[model samples]
Target: MWRYCSLLAQLVMHLDTFRVSRWLKRWRPPPWPALLLRVAVYSGLWWVITEGSGSGWLGLVLALLIALCAPLNVATWPQQLRWRRLPLFIGFMLKNSLFGALIVAQLALSRRCSANTHTRTYRFRLLKGHPQQLLMANLVNLTPGTLTLRLGCDTLSIHILHYQPQIEAQLMMLESHIAALYGLDHEPWEYEY
Candidate 1:
C-alpha cells in the first residue's frame, strides 16, 4: 500500500509541474510577438466592452489570458504567421461570435425545439488529442443546435440538429479560419473549395 501511495504521489507531482509550466507560458509569456498579440487582444476587448477603471478588471485579466495562454489549448499558437492574416482572422472570429449569439437568441425565443428535427452525425476519425481541438469542441457545444459529444483521447463525434448543406459549407469555412489563424501549413488542395 505504501508503494502504491508513493507512485500516486509522484504521478500527481508530475501533473502539477506540467500544469504550472503551461500556465507560466501564457500568464507570463516570453517577450516579443506574443506580447504584441496579448496587447492587441486586450485593447480589442477594452473597445468592445467600453467600461472604465475597475469595471474592466475582469475583462482585462481574461483578455490577457486569451491572448497569452491560448496557445496552451490552441495548437496553432506556436506557429508564426504573415502579418496579412491578422485582419482576416479577426473577421472570422467576429463572424463566428455573431453566429453563436444568433443561435443563443433563437433558442431563447423559441418555446420549443423540434424533437423530430433531423440531425447529422459526424465522426472525426483518428482525431488526435489536441488541446486546441478540445477548445473548439467546447465552443461548438456552447452553440445551440450543435453538440460535440463523446470527446475522446483520439476522436470526436459531433452532432448537429437541423441539417442543411449550408451548415456543412460553414464548417468547411471554419476549418479554413482555424488553419489560417493558427498558421497551419496546409497544402493547396486542402484549402481549395
Candidate 2:
C-alpha cells in the first residue's frame, strides 16, 4: 500500500495539468523607473495622510513596503501613467459626468421615459487587474446613463438609463482612454452583441 501511494504521489506531481515549470520560469523584478515612481506616489500619499509631518523615515519605509508588495507586472504598473495626458483625461471625465447627470435628470423629469436606456454586457480588452478594472467600473457608474452591474474577468455588465447603440462606441472610446492611461497593451476592442 505504501509503494502504491508513493507512485500515485509521483504521478500526480508529473501530471500535464500540474506543470511546475511555469513557476520555475524567471521571476523578473519590476523596472527601476516604475518602482521609483510608485515610491514617490506612495510617499506623497503618506505625506498627505500624515499632514506634512516630518517623520520622513516612516513614509519612506511605508512606500518601499507597498511598492515591493505591488504585483510585479510592467503592464499593470501605475508608473505607466502618462502624466501629460492625465489632466486631459480628468477634464474629459468631468465633462462627461456632468453631461450624464443632466441627461439622466432630463429623462427622469420628462414625460416620455425609456426612450434610449439600455443594458449590455460589454467585454473589455484592458489588462485584468483589480485596481484598473475597479477604476473602469467606477468611472462607468459615474457616467449618467451607465451603471456597472457586474465586473468579470473581461466583461462588464452595465445598465444604462438611456440606451443607444452609440453608447457602445462611447464605451470603446472610454476604454481606449483608460488603456492609454495605464500603459496597457492596446488590444482590439470587442463586445458581445
Candidate 3:
C-alpha cells in the first residue's frame, strides 16, 4: 500500500509539471510588427469614420489609444521576413488579386454563370503563430472569391465562392508565399496540403 501511494503521488507531480510547461509555452510577449498592424488598422478605421475632416489628427490619437488598449494573446512572434522576398510576394498578391477580382466580376455579371460555393477546412504545413494565421485569414478574405470563416489550431476554414479542383492548389501557393514572407523554410512533412 505504501509503494502504490508513492507511485500515485509521483504521477500527480509529473502531471502538474506537464501542465505548467504547456502553459508557459502558450504565453509570450506580443511582437512589434503585430502592434504596428493593429495601429494602422485602427487609424485607417478612424480616418474612415471621420470622413477626411480636419479631425484627422484626432483619428491618429484614437488609433494609438485603441491599439494600446487592445489585448494581445500571441504565443510567439512570427519569424522575421526575408526582405528580399517581399517585393516578389507583394507582386504575387497583387497579380492574383487582380485576377481574382476579374473572375468575381465575370461570375457576377454573367447571367449564365453558376458559382459552386463550398467550405473546406485546410490544415497548413508551416504556419505557426497567430500572426501567420491572421495574415492568411486577411489575405483570403480580401481575395475576391475566398472568404476566411475561421482559424483554428493548424487549420483554416475557408469558404470559396467558386469551388474548383485548382482552388486548393491556389490556396497552397498563397500559403507558400505567406510562409516566404515570414522567412519560413518549409519542410515537406510540415505541410498537409
> For this target, which candidate reaches the highest lDDT against the unseen true structure?
2
Clashes of each: 0, 5, 2
Cα lDDT of model 2 by residue, 35-143, tens digit: 7888899999999999997598899999987887675333466545678889989999999999998988888788877566567898876647677778899999876
Error of 1 at 32 (Å): 7.7
Maximum-TM-score candidate: 2
lDDT of 3 by residue, 1-193 (tens): 9999999999989988778766655545345887787678778887777686648778778877666555434333333757789898888889889988998999989998888989999887777778887899889876668988899887999999988888888888888889878877654553333
* Tens-digit lDDT track of model 1 for 1-193: 9999999999989988778765755653446767677767676767676754435667767777666655556435543545688798677667776777787577667888553344454433222237546755775664445677666654456677656557655654555555555555354432221
For candidate 2, report its TM-score. Answer: 0.64
For candidate 1, the 10 contiguous residues with the lowest summed lDDT are 120-129
**Against the hidden true structure, what lDDT does model 3 obtain?**
0.78
TM-score of 1: 0.47
Candidate 3: residue pairs that collide: 125-190, 125-191
Ranking by lDDT: 2, 3, 1
Provide the TM-score for each candidate, comma-separated: 0.47, 0.64, 0.58
The whole-model lDDT of each prediction reads 0.60, 0.78, 0.78
